[model samples]
Target: MYRYLDSRPAGNSSISLLARAIGKIAQTEGDHTTAIPALTLHRRNAPTKPLHCIYGLGLGVVVQGEKQVMLGDAVIDYGPGQSMVTTIDLPVVTHVARASFHEPFLGLVLTLDSRHVVQMASEMELPQPSRGGVYRPISIEALDGPLVEALARLVGLLDEPALLPRLAPLIQQEITIRLLAGPHGSQLQHLVASGSPSQQIAKAVAWLKQNFTRTLHVDELAARAHMSPSTFRQHFRNITGISPLQFQKQLRLQEARQLMLNQDLDAGNAGGQVGYQSASQFNREYSRLFGTPPQRDVRRMRAN
Candidate 1:
């Protein structure tokens, strides 16, 4: 899509072919985690519905098909030649746009460790920001040969069963280094470094995640991140594009949905487990965020 991705042409090994290979691996092994424990590959057929936000750091590469991930007001798309990189955990609505019986969507997800990202940044002669950089929740760009080749080798290891246990983790680390040197690595560096807003807010985010069920106090969280309440509030909004309360609310609801869908809990009970005092309030918030009530959403997901 973007000028043949630097003369390599993706060759005749089209993304569709890659998708088929990944799909077959999934079929035989049951999940990508089994074949390559270091990376998580989601091989699925395309459809219109969106998936709930998953809070994790990763590089999302599309080997076949297309997808768009929505973060706040921004929508970022990735397909055959592109990928999505998330340096910090944020809520997002993602949808697949292309697929069929003839072609399924193949994608690989690599978990990012912020410490390693910062370490890579420190090793490089990175520029110091003269001013605040661009404000965007997601950034996209073309995938080049280095990224493609690393991914290919990582994927190929699935078939070379005997080599996986020893090799998978190493490749995954290489992929992380590759991304650190790639286009968007600078922003990722800022995210995990001490004193950066991204780092401060991420610290607050981790706290919320670990203590999601507890009642939140803005002042306490701000103190925990070593910032004044006002400064923490402003930075939290800037980095995540959402207020602290809103972030916690999404976390609570998303966790509730997972419980209902995976643990077979009823809607009201799930809400209660996540610090919701009233089921009616939970249903109202769930409907607003998901555009459907909990029971209906879970039922439709199950039928699918």
Candidate 2:
């Protein structure tokens, strides 16, 4: 179990209020998506197996309990009063690390609009982010009083359905402004600033995701991002914590798994659908990543 210590006096009240609100709504052990299209609340009563998925641009806040997320070799653990911001889409493994019947894991994720971020950055006249340093796509930091208050108010709006249409956008904007002005300012700026390394890599990532089923040529991808193959490879690995080939493999395997589970496709068909030409090689890599052969893994997932 994780013990939470709130050192900020002003934030304690808001955090408590937010926790209560989340607990009331997330009464069961599952994910709850509210009327706010971009917001989702999560609840878990016990530790869970690590699940793989793609995390897009969003803000995640843990009002109670603890969770862990793994990006390639990087592992991040965060608890109450801590928030994580992901500026680019990345494949990650995540699980609830600590929770119990008495104190279930409670958290919320708010999808961020990159276009709005660009508009706000322009209006704020924030300087361009530094280009020389390493900037990971994801960051974790302690939530400040203003951000927590804004989030609490956003959740509080759920009580008034009529007011949500009128007020949610304003609070969401406030949350975005706070994030841009907080410790994550530079990272967010890097994501939006034109021709920045992070932005360039983001473009390459977007291309890879859209064309994952096709053959990938490193030089072609690099050229599309206006980077040399070597520089693009380095920046991609630095930001996403995985080489291009590894990233592509993850995408293929994840998609194959979904096809097998949802479409009732056989292992061979799913593998071929995801760009694998050799059945033996596909089964080998599928077992390596998912810890089971395709059919068996699908069965287990369906059973759960």
Candidate 3:
């Protein structure tokens, strides 16, 4: 039996059991929506094809199995007992690297509410950040006792529908509080804090997201964030780990991937729809980023 890292008397369960339940839940209800207000479970068999362009605002916690995600040039890998937090909209390639039918890759995704984070920061007397060193837009770390317990409570609520109505929100708040108190809390704090560089970058991000297909003028984006080009570029790179152009490329490619997956659009049309004018340039870049020519990639992805 695995040890219960959490010291709390109420929230305790074997990891194997929790993993089984989570896997069942994921298999029973596909995708993130099934988790409803608080958490979602994702399970898949071993050697499954990677899921492309998963977009969600949430915390990813692994109960069983392992995963690796690619964000631009950055790659993050996590296994059981670990978690990753996403503070901004990101385009990523997610791999379910380990699983079997009997023991599938099991994980829980807890959606983080910005409002709840802000309120927690206001009430809990957030610890003074010692250093101003930057943090990742997407961060990964080992889970703590408090976080595990909070997650356990959140999962337990899934079985008790009546309690879930009343308790999920409370437990969700508790989980966000725990995250805010954890190692990477400072980033979330800075994200919600007024005048923080991350907040400014978030504004730029919002603009890019809305106007992804539109040609961007850095001058206009800088003006939108109330900062000059030089400062905006520097801080935006710092917060997002990529330059503005790189971020936009990711958004465009992610959108293109969706169009190919959901619609019967051909590669050239999908590229054009995502603002890629030259078919050759689009095909080359698409291959470079997604590791295949558009048609082959889409077909392979669909086969998965």
Candidate 4:
């Protein structure tokens, strides 16, 4: 589905420049965003094992190499000169599909502001989402001229500290405007719509994030989202690619991992903190999700 476009020579140049800029600024492999707010730069020297992380609403530009993001059973792949847009918070297993010491993986990610998107959509008179279509929170497209140039210009600002305060916002606006007018605008339109089903599901997701340590009931979550249980289930799966219960489980497991790694909590304490009443049940579920028992996994993570 992701065919490489041959016609856009300028866009390719922009992508190359983006990769070069990121590689120059990022001395090592990690998020290097100290230079610009909400602008994250990443570099990897080689391919990696699948890693789980929570991806927020943002636009990711793959300046070099390819990556695969797995959400439930769906695998979304993107490569050089490609841009990925995700409209909602998602816990995904991501792998760097292509990279090497010579040509390391380089990427730039921009955190999108929902407020800016909503305001821009209103100003541009974008249409509301149609009622019948299923929603996908993430979409990928080939980079276009305006978006590529805006991103390149934004990264270029790192060298010009004085102009950044004044010009960065303008460039960011241009990038958002390009997205609003592009093929993925409708998806974003629904994401930021206040009372739309997508937003309602987002509200439910927010509640789940806040109350992950507590008991969750489908009916209660549906009521919080202002939808019937069946409708809520349908839209929740459609948008997030997972059930609400699974969503809460991911949050719980991730938090438990953090607690074990950061606070030096034992496996039992970590499990209890994340609402697991039975230690055996917690160990089983944690092994199922992370591919190891909690203590062993924590040991491996700490060693790395």
Candidate 5:
């Protein structure tokens, strides 16, 4: 069984308390989804290899241990008393940088609702995010006292499931309000503000995610976002840390891997399912992204 270090120094009390609450429910090494919608508890007893996935809009708080997220050429590392907010769906390579059997990594993620953010920002009448400044969809901020306390209270609600359905939303709202009023607020504001470059690029990203298997036409996508192709390309890369075509390819490759691993589909069929018309091209791209041939990678993952 995992035990929280109650004897830890008072300076770390808030994080330690959150870790204790997480340790109680997440006794094993994996993601635990709670009855509280869009909330997930994560536990890892040891360090892990790089795992690539799409991180949707959410707030991730690390109560214990450390991790890193790689986006294109950017690398972000965060640990205890730190939180990360991703304002858009982004493909990232993430791994635990620090963890141990005795002191496992513990964390939680709460999905953010864009519509709710827009509603709150409007009511608050916060100043518009500065224009033309490149704001990556993800950012890190040290957790302040009030925000940390609110997060701890949110986890505490699990002990009283009867009150969760009613209280969870209120707590989640508080968390959102804090985020909007905090350092990362500018990025969230950029996401919802009308006609902002981030907002326009976000719309294009949504369409690409939904139609990853379809052929991509940069001009058409740019027009959809109401920008010239050149401007759209620049802003897309600025916000997502990759070109639009690269983003779609990553989405395709990720879905293909999932299909192969979960449904036991063959490489060629999986490739076709994810918009790859040529088996050779798919093999080359798959090997490039995953560091191994499709079959070999699948076998290796299963063995692990």
Candidate 6:
């Protein structure tokens, strides 16, 4: 166990309380999405295998235990008093790295609305970044005291239904502003800036996600983003840490997993629907990525 988990002094009292509140909320809500708007709580009693999904732009603070997210070759590990920020939607592998029945993992996730960020920055006169700056779509940083308190208050609202309607928006706005002023400010600024690489790649990413089943053509996607094939490929990899074809492959596999789990389609049918033509090829790729054949993975998920 980490020493910090056992040592919660006066300085970390709010964080300690926040962990308790998050755990209680997660217990009430189970592992499913709750009725608390964009707020979601997660509690895990044990470590888990790497799970792949699209991580949206959001603020996540681990009040207890730890987690790690893998993007290409980059591995980001965050623990208590630290926060994870994702500026764009990207497919990644993630897992709970540290947790146990005696001290379960507890955390909070809040979605970031770009519209709200723009409105708040305009109202506050926050300075925009220069025209060209490199950006990382995901980052981790220490949570300042005020940010931690704000998140705690936001989660605290879940207990008071009446206060939520009036107070939730204000707290969420505060969080966005704080993030825009923090170390990742330039990244967030470029997110809203017109014609920025981040914004351009975002358009391409959206198109790929919606049309993953179709054959991919880099030139066509580059034309859509107003970039040449080479430039588009470079910027796309910089922002998403994966090439366009790889991104589409992830989307296809994730969709196939859903079809198998929810719709109860056989492996061949599910793979075919996601653009896979050969059953043997689908089985090999599925096993390579998921560590098991599609049927076995789905059955394990159901059993648990």
The top-ranked prediction according to TM-score is: 5
Tens-digit lDDT string for candidate 6 (29-99)? 23546556788888888998899988987887888888888888778888888887888889999999998
For candidate 4, write residues 168-275 as lDDT tens digits: 899999999999888778788888777889889887887888899999899989988888999999989878878999898899999999999999999899999999
What CA RMSD would candidate 4 show? 2.6
Q: Is candidate 5 or candidate 6 better by lDDT?
A: 5
Q: Would you give me the overall lDDT of model 5? A: 0.89
lDDT of every predicted structure (CA atoms): 0.74, 0.88, 0.75, 0.85, 0.89, 0.83
**What is the lDDT for 188 in model 6?**
78
Q: By TM-score, is 1 or 4 better?
A: 4
Candidate 6, residue 34: lDDT? 51
59, model 3: CA deviation in Å?
0.8
State the lDDT of candidate 3 residue by residue for 165-274, as single tens digits: 77788888888888888876886877787777777788788778989999989888998888999999998876666789988988898889889889989988999999
As for lDDT, the candidate ahead, 2 or 3, is 2
TM-score-sorted candidate list, best first: 5, 2, 4, 6, 1, 3
Give the distance in Å from residue 270's predicted Cα in candidate 3 to where it truly belongs: 2.8
The sequence of per-residue lDDT tens digits that candidate 1 reaches over residues 181-237 is 777666666675567676778788888888888999999999888889999999888
Model 2 scores a C-alpha lDDT of 0.88
Runs off by more than 4 Å, candidate 4: 1-10
Query: What value does the lDDT take at residue 129 in candidate 6?
Result: 79
Q: How accurate is candidate 6 locally (lDDT)?
A: 0.83
Off by over 4 Å in 6: 1-11, 28-32
**Residue lDDT tens for model 5, 1-304:** 1111111222378888889999999999999998888889999999999988999999998888988888877888888888899999999999998999999999999999988888888888677777765586888887877888888888889989899999999999999999999888988998988888788888999999999999999999999999999999988987888999999999999999999999999999999999999999999999999999999999999998
